[model samples]
Target: MHVVMTSAGIGRIEDGAVAVLDAPYPDPNTVIETTGSLDALGGAKVVRRIPLDGDELDLRAPLGRPRALWGVGLNYHSKAERTGRPAPDEPVLYLAGSSSVSAPGAAVRLPAEETVQMDYEAEIAVVIGRTLDRAAESEAWSAVAAITAANDMTARDVMKRTGTPALAKSFPGFTPLGASLLARDAIADPDAIGVRSWVGDERRQDSSSADMIFAIPELLARISRYAALRPGDVVLTGTPAGTGQDRDDFLRPGDTVRIEVDGVLPLTTHVRA
Candidate 1:
């Protein structure tokens, strides 16, 4: 089942329509709530059916108030090449706070100063279903509940000036999460999907997650060693090389950014001043 969090509340996509559940999940804040048993709402009937072409509901990230949002930097070979940095001995991790979360249709508010030089990084995000501590690499994928598309919008100038990406990365609405959360069973191979980003018609990133320097299992395993992985935690699997910074370009007000992974729904964000 594809789960979504909308202005109307938690919903399930069926028969090409979004059926609003009778009762929103008791904890409507995290994807973990849907893990293992989305059927918890089995007795609940659909209160309404919103057609896909109907006026779009205000969509929110499938997970509400995630306990932790972890971002991997330069995990993609292409990204490492573009940034002129060698691959790290270990994943370069950053904490993306819940405050940066935004729904698919939300506006990405740019700083008033045009010099912020915002850029977009399209990534495949994994949502954890169970708590994991020092999980074995072979067992990491088992802990994942779902996969979704995410756009890791960055403030390039701010990052360069501050010499820290996390500070610039945590701006409100910097993260535009997918509209649909596809359960793990739905994905044939989580590591082989295509991840791409576009600004209007300009394609900026086009690469597969298979090229990640550290695949999902290894990434999760390594991360688990550092901290406990709880349900509802999100792991952004890093972006490919085609960030705007690579082309000496950047996002501006009025631009629209679209990010997509092969198996999950796409996420679109409007850049606004």
Candidate 2:
């Protein structure tokens, strides 16, 4: 099932059809609090069937307000090789707050004061389905509910200056997430999903999750040990090589970024003036 949250209401794609649920936006925390678990909402009753049109309604990020938006850096072998950095023994973790989250077709506001070198990182985002603490690699995938694609927008100059890239990456609307969330069974093998990105007409990043230095289970196991994972906590499985930085091409005002995960979702964001 392709779960979707929109201004119209909560909806899901069932049997190649879209059905709107008779409820407001399903916030992960609120759902868990009321229903005992996120899984309980999977069978929500369909109230209305609406005609499908991409431009008809406003699509919002599937997770209403993610508790923690975690991201990993240098997890791709090709990305590690390009920056002349060795694959870290563990995942290079970073945090992007909820404020950074944005919906598809939204505008990413450039940092006016410190807008030096902005870049786009196409990544696979995991949506946690349940609470997990110190979960083992064998049980990591069980904790995931859905998957989506994201663009981890960054201000390279701000990162270089503050020595913490999170400052650059967590700016308002920096994280553009897909509006649709594919169920865990949507993909037979999540580890090998395709990730691609484009800056207008130029394809900047094209790679596969198979190239990740640290796989999904490993990342979940490591991150869970340090931070208790809850439903709706997003984990960005690192971007592949060919980032704007590596290509010596950075985003400026009036630029558009489109990122896609072959079997999951695709999202686009525009840099505003």
Candidate 3:
């Protein structure tokens, strides 16, 4: 079953009545309201079935709101090699602002205060289904409910010059995520999915989860050791080797970025000053 948390409400796709699972923290509330039973609201009958029109409603983050936006850097072997960085023994993590979250089709702002080396990185974002701490690799799968495509837009100049990635990465409207959140069951193998990015009609990043230095399960296990993973928190799996910055090409105003991953919907947004 595919699920989405929109500005409208929490909805489960299928012939079912949409259950109101409280705004903002709907994932945990939905689980609690259903008493651990996904079908607790009665059945597919009770869910309010509404027609999905892409233009009618705005797609918020898969979760109405997330606690933190955690991202992995250089997890892809090819990406690490391109930047002359070693493949990390563990996930190289960073935090993007929760305020940076924007939906697909929205305009991503280029930070005028910063240098013009803005780049696009296509990644698979993991949406946590439940709160967990020190979770084992085998148990990590249970903690994730859905997956979506995310563009980890960055300002390479700010990152390299200031030596502070946070400044470059956390700009407002930097992360543009897609709408559809594919359920775990829909994705048979998370580590085998394909991810690709395109600038206009040109295909840029083409890679598979198989190339990840540290796979999703290991990343979840490693991250959970220190901080508690809460429901609705997003873990942005690293991007592949073909980022514009790596090629010394940067995004210009009016360019469109499209990211696609197998099992999830494609996300497209435009760049603007």
Candidate 4:
């Protein structure tokens, strides 16, 4: 079932109608409530009448306020090779401020003072469902609720000049995530999906999750050792090799960036000054 948490309400996609769950799950005040406990509420009662139109509502991040936004870098073998960096034994993690979260179709503002090497990276994002510490690889799957497409927009020039990539990556509106979060059960194999990115009509990056050096399970296990992952926190798996920075081309104003992942939703955003 495709689950979408929007400002309107939580919607579940069914065969014919969309089930709209109440505002807060497992609560009585919720106009449309689901059955079972928080953990066991698996599509028992669905609130019908809600529309599936992706528009008409302001879609916030999958979660209202995530504790932290964790991003894995150079996890893709090809991307690592392009950057002249060897594949690491573990995931290379970076922190993006929670305020940087923006929804699909939003405009990504180019930092005027920074260099003009703004680039786009398409990635698969994992949404954590429960709080966990030292989670084992075998048990990590249970902690994830869904996966979505995310564009890790970056300022390459600023990163190179400042000597800190995180500085450029953490800018507000830098991460434009796709709408419509696909439930974990909806995907049969998370590691085998295809991912692609486009600048307007031209394709930029094309790759698969199978090429990831450290897969999702292993990434979760390793990251959990350092810090506790709270519910609604997101871990963005790294992008593929074909980012604009790899090709030495940057985004210009009025450019449209689109990302599509098989079985997941498509995310599109425009570049603006």
- Give Cα-based local distance difference scores for all models: 0.82, 0.81, 0.76, 0.75
lDDT of 4 by residue, 122-184 (tens): 999887776669989888877777678889888888878886757878777888875666767
lDDT of 1 by residue, 2-38 (tens): 7777778788777778888877474333436454434
Give each prediction's root-mean-square deviation over alpha carbons. Answer: 2.0, 2.1, 3.5, 3.8
Kindly report which residue stretches of model 1 are placed more than 4 angstroms away from their true locations once superposed. 24-44
Residue runs of model 3 more than 4 Å from their true location after superposition: 5-8, 12-58
Deviating ranges (above 4 Å) for candidate 4: 15-19, 25-58
Candidate 3 TM-score over all chains jointly? 0.86
TM-score for all predictions? 0.92, 0.92, 0.86, 0.86
Sort the predicted structures by TM-score, highest score first.
1, 2, 4, 3
Residue pairs that clash (backbone atoms under 3 angstroms), model 1: 29-64, 30-64
Worst 10 residues of 1 by lDDT: 28-37
Best by lDDT: 1
Number of the top TM-score candidate: 1
Q: Where's the lowest-lDDT run of ten residues in candidate 2?
A: 28-37
Which residue pairs does candidate 2 place in steric collision? Answer: none
lDDT of 2 by residue, 44-83 (tens): 7888766556456567776666778999889999999999
Ranking by lDDT: 1, 2, 3, 4
